[model samples]
Target: MPITEILSYGFMQRALIAGTLVAVLCAILGVFLVLRRLSLIGDGLAHVTFGSVAVLLLTRVGAQSVSLAAIPLVMLASLGILRLTDKARIYGDTAIGIVSSLGIASGVVLASVAGGFNVDLFSYLFGSILAISPMETWIAAALFLIVLVAIALYYHDLFAIIFDEELARSSGIRVAAINRLLVLLTALTVVLAMKVMGIMLISALLIFPAVTALQVARGFRSTIVIAAVCAVVSVVGGIFVSFVANLPTGGVIVLVNAVLFVAAYAFRRCKE
Candidate 1:
């Protein structure tokens, strides 16, 4: 099928628009998380989204509202991960692991109690971007703008904290606030991205683009730009390929990102 024919379908149009927006969001936030070694947080929070979706499913919430409602619940879980690290004296990965385990466990038990997974739950598990509603697309666009603006406002503080929290704090950067903000933003992005990449593969969207950019980018700003471009390309390319091949869009998108990473790594080595 020609690209123009594919773009003629409304569902395809929605998928492209929303997927691109969420991909860019993940790429930008992934840079900060990757630099700080908090990339796992995306995976961790993705599990939390699963649990949150399970709860919403159990309540029989409308499909459209589930994403919005999951936002706060997952945000709270993200903060809990932060608290575990700060007050419980746990390592960051351990804290993420604890929260991740709890989230998946809750979802599993809930699934069992609810008489196993339903189609709705499965859609979220693996993603259904081609079925994204009009409202969800607007949500993606709105949150994309909000997060982009927030990052722009806090870029310097985030940059400082990513390199050295102690120094950023000593420099009067309000390390705790910035840390919370970062996690909160990440949580929001993860929830929004669940539709684009699903619970199982969402972190790839966050990690791959940013890391791939690091292999070739010469500066921080350039890294962000490159990552965003990579993510957008993956989403667009993945959607078209998946459409033509009748494959899962989310999986194809991740594979596209993986291919980019390998190519970037090879290029970096060749340069060296």
Candidate 2:
């Protein structure tokens, strides 16, 4: 089928728009996340998002409520977890590992107890790029706006704080506050993308493109710009590939990102 044919369907169109918006937002967030060495944080949040979705399923929250109510709660919880980790002087790495296991366990147990919610549990697990709703499309757009503003307003502070939180705090940056904001934004973007990207591998969408950009970028500004562009390309390409190949949309998108990262890393390694 012609690429145009994919966009002709209402669902396909919605998916495409949703994917585009999410691809951009996730890429930008991933830039800072990577710079801050918070890659595992993305993975943990992904699991938490899955757990939250499981709750929505168990609670019999209407489909619309999943992204709205559950997502924020998950984000807030993630922020709180981070704070607890920070304040307790627990290593973030260990905390992420602990949190990830608990979050994913919650999802699985809830799934089992409910005797399973939606057969579309597979879709939530791996993402179904073809099933985006119009409401999801709007939500993604609004989130992108918010994320972009946050990035612009806090760019220098974030970069500094990510490099050295104690130093940034000493220099008058609210490192703790900024970290909270970043985690919340990350959680929000992850939720928005969960429909198209799926919880099972949504972290790939957040990390891979930013990773690819990081390989070639000389500085933060260039990295963010390149990551955003690469993300758009990956989403559009992955959607089309999955459509044509009849692959799992989330897996296909993540596979594409994986291939690109490997290729980029190889090229950079050879150059160095």
Candidate 2 residue-wise lDDT, 210-234, digit = tens:
8899898888889989898888888
Q: For residues 239-267, write the lDDT of model 1, one tens digit per residue.
A: 89998999999999999999999999999
For candidate 1, list the clashing residue pairs, or say none: none
Candidate 1 TM-score, true structure as reference: 0.99
Off by over 4 Å in 2: none
The best candidate by lDDT is 1
Q: For each candidate, give its TM-score against the true structure.
A: 0.99, 0.94
Off by over 4 Å in 1: none
Clashes of each: 0, 0
lDDT of each: 0.95, 0.82
